[model samples]
Target: MPRDPLSRLQWLVFALVSAVFTTVYIPQPVLPVLRQTFGVGEGTASLTVSAVVLGIALANLPFGALADRMAIRPILLTGGLVVAAAGVVSALAPTLPLLVGARFVQGLFVPALTTCLAAYLAKVMPAERLNVVMGSYVSATVVGGLSGRLLGGFVFPPGHWRWAFLVAAALLLAATLAAYVGLPVEDHEKARQAEGVRFRDVLFRHDLFRIYCVSAGGFFVFSSVFNYMPFYLHGAPFHWSTRAVTLLYLSYIVGVVAGPLAGRLSNRIGNGAAMVVGSLVFGAGLAVTLIPQGWAMALALALVCAGFFTIHASAAGALNRKLSTGRGRANAFYTLFYYLGGTAGITLSGHAYHLAGWHGVVALAAGVLLVPLSTGLVEMRLAQRDGSATRSSVARAR
Candidate 1:
């Protein structure tokens, strides 16, 4: 068999998508700095982090539909440009409102990049390599996330917040150019000629509904922990500097190791089982973080990263394959819920933090994880029942 060219394209797409996502999250570590500099309250400052996610969630479905209609490359290019422009605008905004608006616009472009990129990869890659490639892409995203936080924290000391955005914009621009030059252009006419079912119908299916809920619930828990951890650490006995706090993102490397491994494991065991185990592990990891000590916190963060990546990798890959039609749309639906949860989780957890403190936040997160953990178990049982039914049918046919 000849080697697959699409696999290479998927790798490049992963890189480009990861870079764009990095630009969106670069403000996370600097949220407190923005609060102080802009003279805003903590709730308002947190909007700097939440707005982009809200934007991504709002745009995911539209962009996914667009990808089904248009060539993926053009959509991706436009998204990249819009995101970069938003970054520049955000870096230059003089007021909190203007910066928030720019961040929202930056987020709007995010789904275009991410949705198109994922769909493009799905269209190009072979089934055998799909999980591995997606795993790599997920790891790249984790790295981008880590880099974004580190850059924001390390670079924005006193008056250097703008530099963080500038650096992110530059990196995104470079990645965009690389993507434009390296990615293969899709043939629109051929894509149009290939017959497939409409995505709206796919949305109405019961099986997919379960999957979307699982994906969303899983991400909600994942984002809640990551988004609030720094805030929690900044408050307590640790009272770490921004740079010191951002260094916690170094734990994201655990996801880098776990993603591909989880993907491979999902291929062997059922994805439902993988998702269940991963969610359980993630919940346990969050439990570890309740220790209130720095070293224990570090260990808990590492476990959180591992568990998040494991569940996310498996669930996302399963989503791509679960649907018989409208794969792109399905993925978009997953992304929509995924990011929506992120936005909701961050905003809601902020309140939890205010009300009950770090313990409250952890409890809220664990409660959210339980939703997906329970869903995964249900999915596993359903899969087993289906398998038994199939075997019985085969026996009757024989």
Candidate 2:
């Protein structure tokens, strides 16, 4: 018999991965509510987000390594179950400290879902279709993120903050079950080989190192905006409602298009070119937030999401191509730095917001985008020199 089509399996895994990842971020739009409910300050409530990011950053390496040793399905299922349990614990926590702790635990499990899912997809999908499928996965993640923020904000107004966690838990549980049932079982040897390559061997490759740096920088820029924008809107003249603020995430819909489009565009121009142009677009979008108006702010956020997703999809695809071994570990390392940037950049931006208000936050974000833009420039020049050498070799061969 012909093999079963993997498309359905791909979508199921994507949804499960997205929902699990979204659980970590559900508290972001509700930070103000968390502060009021827990009798804490904004910075402390913000810890609810930063702590989870720290956990993800810390756990990425170990989980990626584990995916190399163990079965992908089991790792993903275990992580999903742990995340669901953490959501329940978060919902029931009697104190802010307890809640933050639960969130940290939830974060710990998330990397298994993220890193393993990517490796699993890479193993199962044809190389030609990898970018398209990965783009869909990225889009699903954005949708989950938007849903979490919107649901959390909406549920809190009626004194139902617990419901938000409960709902997230339910979604995660469903995802876990679907994944357990639907994902095909690969041979353990294949899984190990896919993940088994030594991290040191992978790191020795120059191209992979360049891709990792660019990927890290792209995520750094993306996280800076997502982490800070809600806080900025909640302050100043706008003072948007939880619902209205949650609606800001609707802009992520642009990412649904930008990601796949960027992948296709990368094929034409090159991943480095896509990264450079995308960073420029992202910077331009961040600058637009300085415009005063609810609509203008919304448009700026949409542009940021679109641009960020474009660069993110292309960079990640490029990184996967460059890695010769320990793909899972390499992905984990990429995410480690990615969430590290999120944790450090957002926490620092809190201070910037404290010092300079929204303008300060915008300036800080715009400045951080420079890191990735510069990396992209360096990558382009390197690609050019290599291309020239190849052409010279071809002329001599002729």
Best by TM-score: 2
Q: Estimate each model's TM-score.
A: 0.91, 0.92
Per-residue CA lDDT of candidate 1, range 1-398, in tens?
11576556666766776787678678777777787899986668878878998998998887776766677777777888888888999899999999999999988988777777777666656688766766656667877888787778875662587988887898888888778778766667644443276667767887787778777777788778877777778886778878887888788888778887888888888788888888888888888888778888788888888778777777777776776667766777777878888888888888897899888888888888876677678868988998999999999999
lDDT of each: 0.79, 0.78
TM value for model 2: 0.92
Off by over 4 Å in 1: 1-11, 123-136, 155-159, 191-195, 390-398
Q: For residue 180, what is the lDDT in candidate 2?
A: 81
